[model samples]
Target: MGSVVEHKRTDKRTGKTVTQYRAHIRRVGFGSRSKVFATKREALDWIRNNESDNALTKRASAGGKTLASLIEDFIAAGVCQYASQAHLAYWCDQLGNKLVSEITHGDINGALLSLRTRGGRRFTPDGIKPSGKPLTPATINRYAAALSAVFNFAQAHGVIDAHPMKGGKVKKLKEGPGRQRILTPEEETRLLETARAARWDGMYLFVLMLLTTAARKSEVLNLRWRDLDLGRGIAVLGKTKNGAARALPLVAEVRKGLAELSKVRPINSDFVFYDPKQPGRPKNVDTAWQFVRERAGLNDSDDPVHRVVLHTTRHTGVTKIIRNGANLAQAALISGHKTLAMLKRYEHLAADDVLQLAEHALGKVGTGSSKG
Candidate 1:
């Protein structure tokens, strides 16, 4: 139901009264928006149009919103803004012309199949070419997630009645274990030497932080100078992957490196690992990482598990922290993981070479259990 009210106002200079009509309505989950008009008839017309318009708009928009329109909304809202929105182009070609509301789980599966076969591209310095590697199930799930998010956003904004994802029905790609490469002490020494030899700003410090703290690349990169408590030897990471705040221990090596880097660090910038060129933002470490890994001769592995990348430092760090005697709860706090299940995934990645520690523990238990 809608109601109209005539608002009366008196002129300051002239002894005259002004009348205005305002109409307001509430449409349950569809939400509320109102319009005011000079004439009562105009307000009544707007109320009539808006009330009926919501219903008609829902039908027309749901029926006529093509996949291309969804992508447009996705970009506008910065859903997949990273990769310059090119990663989603394959989906645009497959489902761009189809209506969003009518798109089915079968359609999504079909698109995933197309990607796995020959529906995507690979870019080179010269131009675009057919992608050699087929899309992984994990990658396909990511695309499905992005698409589901588009629908979810629509539903949240009252553009659609409900999202079409319907839980995990549309997202059905089983993924195997994630990457699991731990760097040996020898490799660590060599990699650090290589990074220092290359002479890039923040490279050495960033590497040391990941190796020492088991912090993600994003968490390390997103750190501000203010986040550090130099006196207390702790770094507060507020923008962690789990979206919670945690304090990262600043080890002797990381603390020493930070002290040296702080001398040359930009005082104007807040970031601890900020780019010299763009002091406000984190330095782009990908190119430097690839270069250093290639220089150290560690980039030829076929399996992602064997790949010695920047994130390998985090894995190695976590495993080392646990091996040196931190429990799962301590590891989770250091790594900023929200759950033990996530730690279990890491445990699966890392080989258990500490069986001797378990034996030693059993020996202690047996000694303690002895009856005199």
Candidate 2:
């Protein structure tokens, strides 16, 4: 009930011909399945394993459940992480109509490939638009992982018998280094001045807190009066991206700004950046941020890494911390980076700083000339 077909194709990267095997399996009362493999042995092995598993689970019917329904059930189970919900919802939009049994490795793989090449839909001023840039390898992998979680949940609940993406059937793409952009002194000054003049009252304080505390945009925007301690010059982030609580040190300028902001705080809301129109919600700062960045000339660069965004302030803060004599561990404590590896991207030093450090350590070292 299975077959392996050999095919030859030119490798796009190497321009050399290579052989590939496509394994196909079909059993009574089961949908057809196929997967491509790099070697004949692999193809044969896949066919055998699938046939054996199908025989044992012949009574199970994954056909009754659609992927969309399964995704809804998975979401209802409360197992998905907050960040992964969007990615899982995307899979629902793509393959939701298909029955769980009809889904295959090739389907998932092709969808991921398309996601990498074509990017995803994004919201803009005009309306929904396709992203201008392709999703990075890391992003693609995240999408795949999120969908895989749905499949795993289905299998655990007896909604599906097998996972198409199991056992590393879908290989992850190699990810490059993370972005390391930091603002120059001139850029920082221009951004602050523009933010100070911004019509949005919270813009200046938000940007200042981002730079001084190295807090993420979400963290700063979600701040409440209870989270701040101006007397101790500290702000506690009770919830963070890494699921850990961390404290951010508020400098004199940041403390003074907050003190002023508190005086004008709305009597109705507790949020630091509460929307005036809807005091229950945080202010939508995206439009105001875009305006400020464009006015300050920070958005002139087309390169995403070089283009200044809210997160760029965090990078600038961490770099400045390191430049001002703080080691990686010390910087991590201030920036709330969960690990040194995650914080390593901000370990940038100027050539002048490196030269001075070298001079300071080896200025009086003597050569072995014996004075002869």
Candidate 3:
């Protein structure tokens, strides 16, 4: 059983009185449902759906398990523990009490669409700001993947007969080539100088380490004194996004910086990079990084067109690795990328570099290879 309530409120944008509808549903043992809608019809419609789902659950608890219980089991399984926990939580918050076996493709798609449109920073100083940027295909795909993992796990454990996301019922968006914003030598110089100007010792070294090893931000931030084998010029990374401990070779520039820091190191803290404000913990570079990025003129757009940011250092480093004569396989090994396809995606070719490759294919003729 459910009821809809109508209330009048002033619109933030229009500055006019408007009617808002709030629907409430109360079900024994399954808990209560409530949602606000712009129209009474919409509110009533949602109430009807809740009544239907609740009725179905009472009939037999759809395959003897609810989505809410599945989430608890899935969390115990720890498949998407950190990297994608929030994405999974978003789905669970909405659909948790529903039966996994009864959850349809439409259910998942509708939630994704609502998330894209309705997720906004409301009541800001500038009033309601529509998320200026629409979600990218890559981002949407990641959300799909997180949900897919949960359903797959549920099916594998015999909780469901089949998963809706499987067999192309819900298709992912066709993503474009990954972002590639390799820095020029001048830009690199300016960025390093700007980091120094920011006056965070960790920022300068971290920037150098990123350019040198092509390590992810979290990878470098987790580094400790014992993690470095400076004499051998390699770093052993115990914790990584992929859950595999691997080694990243230290380039001369990074080695030089690390060597300088090692002499003045504090024995009290084992962390290689520390916040001067807190010596025991890993350095908090966010504020210093913001300053450095602005000073270095970094763009913060995820427009999928192209932009440079701290993470762009990985793209830049990988491009330089391949340009400096590392083959695709070698580049993958160095950057710890699992596949050649991923390695190639990180290798952004400059227009001039492509022209040179064309020139090389055509063969070098007179006086250092130029035609007048």
Candidate 4:
């Protein structure tokens, strides 16, 4: 039921007279708030629309949740089983402040766009480059996913009728260039020699792991000694990105590298790669790796590989495997990517070469029919 009441009142200081109509509407879950109008007809119209919006808000509130409340609940549940707390915290910070009723698809799009605008940045601990760097599209995609998950979770929990994010589209930015810079045979030898000559103990082994397994630097650092099954010739990766446990076989050189690491490995820490200076701290070899890159004499001011960091090794490995005739599925599995499409991006061949290979495989070798 709804009612419109007319009233006359006087202003306090100015003492001006006023006549107004106040619409009183009954909400299913929330109490009424007075809406003022100039006339009875306008007040009635106001009540009609207010009633509809109030009903939606009431239903959402009935389950003891609001949009904002649901997001906090999702974060508090600690549902990101495989994600680092810092990662989850980042998403929480991004979306936690908005009231559910106030959020729109535009807000979600803006957040992703902001991430794209900033390249990628790393923490220095010394407060040097506080902004770090702009983030990659892949990284931005992860944040978008997390945001989507939160909104979806809210809808499922009855906090909202539909996820604003589910039907919405985000303009995906382009993926960054692959870190794969295939080392020439001579360059590969020189890089290894340089790593061997490094003052660091595990530098040689780190280089070997990169060349053999194509494991990302972070993934390699996260590896535990127990993850290795030397007899089976496989290294079980229990913790990598994408929340899947994968097994990587040891190449001949990888096997020898692990054997060497076993001799000098510390019995206390569980890590296969640990730092000596930061004892018990798992090796974060990026800084040491930069030094190795410089010593190799391959560095230049304009080279993309200069900013390549250590993940380039993983990229290099994947490229070499594909070049050596490994199947896409095999490379995807070894690289721990969720899709075959991602593996295709790692192969650095020219567009013509791709067409040529497709034609040859499809029995249309020299013909342009493959493109068609």
Candidate 5:
């Protein structure tokens, strides 16, 4: 049982009316009632609401979870199954401090804006500094996407009422046009002959794999004999950037390179490209590559043609396939890109292709003649 009573009194110091509520709280023994409020309405409301023990318990116990708890739950669950564990740690660092209820759309926007302002540095172990460059739209969009995944999980579990990133759109910046760089037949012959004559151990095979199979440096370097099916002309990539496994078709030159590498592979190691000095580790050609570049008179790092890092081999492969008149869909599949948009970024027509088009359009014989 509860009783609500109010008394109007004057403060001796201030000489002002002080309205207070005194209630007879049953659970406690104090005179006849335990009084504790400055207003009669507030006292009555407390008396009515506190009458149910279950209601008090429900109010106190509900909504008790915090942002940190939710992030831990996400990490422990299957979220890190395919994605890098470091990425999970990064998300926790960025968004884990705020209370779940306190996070708003504006907070997410501020985080993304911060990323754009620090463009050059990756979200690595080292911190990102503000590059003072304008934010790229693609980068901003990726941040929005990563945030959406976390918030979507939060919403599904009732940690958030609705995802802050839900229905939010990011404006993408116009991408700069790609400059195509494809070697001509003469250049290709020269490059291949130079590779053969250079007589560097496995350098010939590495170049052949780049020009023929179009395998990325990481993929080619990490290639294991178990993943290769020479009979089927397939190289199975166990983990790819798209978070899926893919297979790359092997070409004749790629097969020849693999055959050569097979004779040189160590007995204990299964890596198709293992270095003898490193034993188990993939051969690192970084320093040796610079040496070769200098010897080949291709040391100008600033020149796009000479800027041919190890990755350029894969680029050459894609350009070759595209210049051979492969459709966008086929090229995308071959490259393991999730969409045609990414394939378009790698597409380069050879200079010979442009010359061929010009000859066809202008009619080579008539264009050469003055009709005197």
Candidate 6:
């Protein structure tokens, strides 16, 4: 609803009275707007124009948004994880120009299928190049899950009446078994020795923490001094991929390495792995890690199944814990794995070890029967 009111005021310079018309509008779900005009007709005209535009805007927002715009809003809301944000950004590049209402199940399915052959983008000295390897079903599912989140956000916000991914319009592909790569004793020894001699003084400590703590690369890099309690020999991860805080136990060797590194810690920063150039930020050790891995002869092949990467350190740590007689629950606590299913992948054991355990248990029963 709207109304127009007339007012009279004395002009200070001319010492004359002037009249003006003020038009005011108040509508539900909209902010009130008022404007003054010299003539009542002009005031009424402005109100009519604004009201008409407002009605049109309301109608358009219901179904006229582009996928990119909705993605922008979703990002602004800051509800998704960091990894999902990257996936969503990739979607913005793929379907940004398309209208939300026009997107169909086929469109999404086709996009995911295309990802299989297209592979992941990799940066090389020559520029961006496709990895040439087809994306695994698990990787493809991650992309699908990211897109599903956006559609879910749109539905909750009333931007769309129905979910495009609903009713299993797009299904998750079956993922292969998880990687079971673990560092052999010789490889672990060689890796640590190489890291100790690397030019980057922090390399040894960083690798040691990863191998000992079973923490992710990002989690280790983001570690701060305050997060550590040297007396307790534990590191508190305040933020993790699972959005839960967990504590990582520090071994005697790790505690010694950290103690030595803290002696050279910069006074201006709290980050344990603070960048030399930017004291306020954590150091990116990708190049350093690559150098150490190559020098250690760990990068002999491009095979993902056997390739030793940063994440392999986590896998190694968890695998070693299970091999050393720790159960799945104990390993999950150290690895910060939220589910036992995810932790099960690292439960690899040697055939000899399994046989020995079976013999040890049955041997006692056989001895008792012989005595009887």
In terms of lDDT, which candidate is strongest? 6
For residues 76-97, could you state the per-residue lDDT of candidate 6 as single tens digits? 8866654466678778888888
On a 0 to 100 scale, what is the lDDT of residue 286 in model 6?
A: 75
lDDT of 3: 0.77
Give the local distance difference test score of model 6.
Answer: 0.83
Tell me the deviation in Å of residue 323 in model 5. Answer: 1.4
Candidate 4 clash total? 9
Clashes of 2: 0
- Please write out the lDDT profile of model 4 over residues 294-356, one tens digit for every residue: 888656444453444566677777877777778889888788888898787766642335766
- Give the per-residue lDDT of model 2 (tens digit) for 257-345: 89998999988899999998998789888889999999998887767667678888988888888889888899888887889998766
In order, what lDDT does every prediction score? 0.75, 0.82, 0.77, 0.70, 0.64, 0.83
Off by over 4 Å in 1: 1-54, 58-99, 118-131, 267-269, 349-354, 361-372
Please write out the lDDT profile of model 5 over residues 1-372, one tens digit for every residue: 788777888998999999887876454321122446887777888778766666434333323455556767766765523334444455567776776656767776676666666554334235645444564565456555555666667777755555656554434445444334544466555556666665457776666676676767767777888989888898998887676788988888788778777877788888887777776888766655565555555444654344656566667778778888887787767776778887766644454577777766665565566431
Every model: Cα RMSD to truth: 13.5, 6.8, 13.1, 11.1, 13.7, 15.6
| Models ranked on lDDT | 6, 2, 3, 1, 4, 5
Ranking by TM-score: 6, 2, 1, 3, 4, 5
Q: How far is candidate 5 from the true structure (C-alpha RMSD, Å)?
A: 13.7
Clashes of each: 0, 0, 1, 9, 0, 0
lDDT of 1 by residue, 22-71 (tens): 88766654444456779999988877876785564565656577878877
Q: Which ten residues in a row have the lowest lDDT in candidate 5?
A: 25-34
Which residue runs of candidate 4 sit more than 4 Å off their true CA positions? 1-93, 99-102, 116-120, 128-139, 149-161, 176-180, 277-281, 301-307, 348-372
With a 3 Å backbone cut-off (N, CA, C), the pairs that clash in candidate 3 are 68-96
Instruction: Output the worst ten-in-a-row residue range by lDDT, candidate 1.
Output: 78-87
Estimate candidate 1's alpha-carbon lDDT, on a 0 to 1 scale: 0.75
The TM-score values for the models, in the order shown, are: 0.71, 0.73, 0.69, 0.67, 0.57, 0.75
Question: Which numbered prediction scores highest in TM-score against the true structure?
Answer: 6
Q: By the TM-score metric, which is better: model 1 or model 4?
A: 1
